[model samples]
Target: MDVLTDLLQRSRARGAAFSHSTAHGAWGVRFPVGAQLAIHGILGGEAFAWTDDAGTSRHVLAGDIVLVRGSAEHFMAHSPGAETVSFLGHPSVGPPGGAQRMVFGEGPGSSTTFFCGAYTFVGDLCAGLLAGLPELTVVRPRSGSSLRATLDVFAGELLDDAPGQQALLDSLLDVVLVQALREQLAADVHAAPAWFRAMDDPTVGSALRAVHAEPARNWTVADLAAEASVSRAVLARRFTALLGVAPLAYVTDWRMALAREQLREGATSLAAIARSLGYASEFSFAAAFKRHHRMPPGRWRTASRRQAAGLASV
Candidate 1:
């Protein structure tokens, strides 16, 4: 799909409250497969547990951003316990001592507490990226940094519980997810996929921006190379080196993504979408869509809508 749609599909939105006390000792929170990424920010007290996915666990504490890109089943608690729960446990235990989860560094004691959220990806490209990451990504806040302050604000807002509280929390979760993505991208050292690295190359980034900004344009290698102020060969070489795909192929994929999004939104007819994406005929557009997505545009739209509906029900 288009880059923006890819981001949304490979992401999910969720917010949760956690607590701990002497009676219950340790507990776990399980997350199902719908989310591609999850971020846990300590909101209050201290939270301790072995964060595990596929049986490997790491300890998490307050002021830590536990990022689970694999969306694996994991838990946070006061102690590591013998019993484990599936990702779909019901009416889970609240935090200890009847204390609601609170903002970290607020109220009284050094109790560990936090707010967590998860994001599931729906698009193919994003799903691939998520599949490539480790089970968990942890970001410890730097002292006196804006990220730390932002986390504090997030925890504070969560504690308020004002009107439209759920929606507000959802928005905060989005912010946390975006920040985590940005940090992960910056720290990633391995060879990344085209979309992830394209934004970092001057020439390729410019070309990508142009394509995304106007996928309807009649784009050619010559035109894009000229726009990037490079010879055709040099442009092609650099683009492929950085993005791992030829320029034309990338443009074609972007067009397909844009068309898929438009179709799913029911914003335009197939013919209109084809024309707007620079295709001369609806048949030509359908053929391209079939090649990329393995289905005709209409069928893909129906299937995608059905999948989204199923996720909502879950």
Candidate 2:
């Protein structure tokens, strides 16, 4: 898989806090910042998307899908001046695998309709990916675009309590979200992480997949190039050019990321973790970890556990 696909999968990104909101004249609903990401789709009449306290707004119309790239409060409204209701921490953020609907304007003339959902992503993978995106991203339909098709299906499934509807809606939402992300990143390739943009180089992409798939392996430029069917010098140049890091540095960073996860889990021996990450011994691993993380692995693990405990109590 390419780097973007691999990042999202490894992060365990999934939908949460879903809602199918319907409204009429003078309506607004605010989705507060807590979800890892949020998606707001305008399935019916025109509306306005209010993104921040600074009063920034974007006009959205029918068939438009907006992906909020990070955990920040945003809203949709019938007009820029509509009264707003907070959806965050509301009882409507319901049980697992189910959705809620909120109707506004309190009249039978519900002219506008939309569906919204928030995403929950685990792990550090989200940080690097979302950092490269603007706070708000909207997808306007174009002729013959598969994104519009997916959004259409998503819209139809809403308010329909047919059998297996939850599963179908989840699938459709994922498709539309992924397509919106792909389109946004494609529009501004520079907005994507360097590793994702690096796929333009076949050798770099191959090497990335190799390192990600078997991070425990002892990887060198020559070894990776041999696996990728490219010369050592070519691989080094291309890898550096695209990822802004040498191949070995990338491997070390990837390994340390894994080590951090293991540390967070707090369920394995330090030596075992080091070995799984391809270190010769725990001593060597600790030294390397200190050099990168600015603290010893054992101490880091302890601190992480303590912090988690504190949060759990809260």
Candidate 3:
């Protein structure tokens, strides 16, 4: 699997709470801080978007998309600093599969048609993909780009109340999420995470791909070097320099992340998780996990699940 695809799958990101609305002249909507990630697309007209503390807004024209990461309260409006109202539970913005139609301003004025959606992530593993993003990332739709084409189709689907429309929209939202991440991350290479940026390097990228493709394999420096067609010393130096960690160390970290997710879910036996992550036995996996997390795997799993339950109740 490629890096982004692997991260998305392992992180278990899911689409949630989609709504389509139109606003006319002098209108703003406040989105409460909740969703881990949110996306807004401008199908027609224009608007401005910014976080609560940003103090400035980004102008988004027709055929533009804005991505906001983290649990930051944000706003979208026809004009910057416009008076705002709570978006959640609004009459027009009902639950999934319901129609949404919002209106603002009494006069006949220019209207902005937009669609908004939220994404929920299961665990901190998602930080692998979302951690490096700024609070608000905007992308202008380029003519002939897949993102623009997909947005056009999404807009069309929003108008139809056909069967399976919800499922179709859900799938489209996933596509939009991936495409937006690919475009924005590529556009701002300097701000992207080292693992993502490293994927462009021929030697390091090849070795990384091999590791992700078969993470359960017992891999040595020489093994990964061969996959990249380079010497062990060369691959080690480059991988460390680019990722700030040795190749084998990165493998262990990734494996541990997967292990934690499985443990959190309270599914799969310890031995199964161990073997899947290339551990010789459950004992060895427990030892390594304890060394890294300062707690035994079983104890850590219990504590983590308890904490999750507490939070969910709140």
Give each model a TM-score: 0.74, 0.88, 0.95
Q: Which pairs in model 3 have colliding backbones?
A: none
The candidate that wins on TM-score is 3
Candidate 2 C-alpha lDDT tens digits along 1-314: 56677677777789742787778877778777777788888888888886775367888988888878665678778778577887664445333455677676655454787888777876676688787777887777577889888877787777666767677777777777788888777778877888877776678888998888888898888899987899999989889988888999999998898888888878889999989999999999999999999999999989988988897898
Total backbone collisions, model 1: 22
Comparing 2 and 3 by TM-score, which wins? 3
Poorly placed runs, candidate 3 (over 4 Å): 93-99
Give the alpha carbon lDDT tens digit for every residue of 151-221 in model 1. Answer: 77776765564665556566666666656555665567463455667776778777777787777888999
User: Candidate 2, TM-score vs. the true structure?
Assistant: 0.88
Off by over 4 Å in 1: 1-6, 9-28, 31-34, 44-53, 69-71, 80-110, 121-125, 142-145, 262-268, 290-314
Candidate 1 has what TM-score?
0.74
lDDT of predicted model 1: 0.64
Question: Which 10-residue window in model 1 sums to the lowest lDDT?
Answer: 16-25
**Pairs of residues at least 3 apart in sequence or in different chains that clash in candidate 2:** none
Model 2, residue 174: what's the lDDT? 76
As for lDDT, the candidate ahead, 1 or 3, is 3
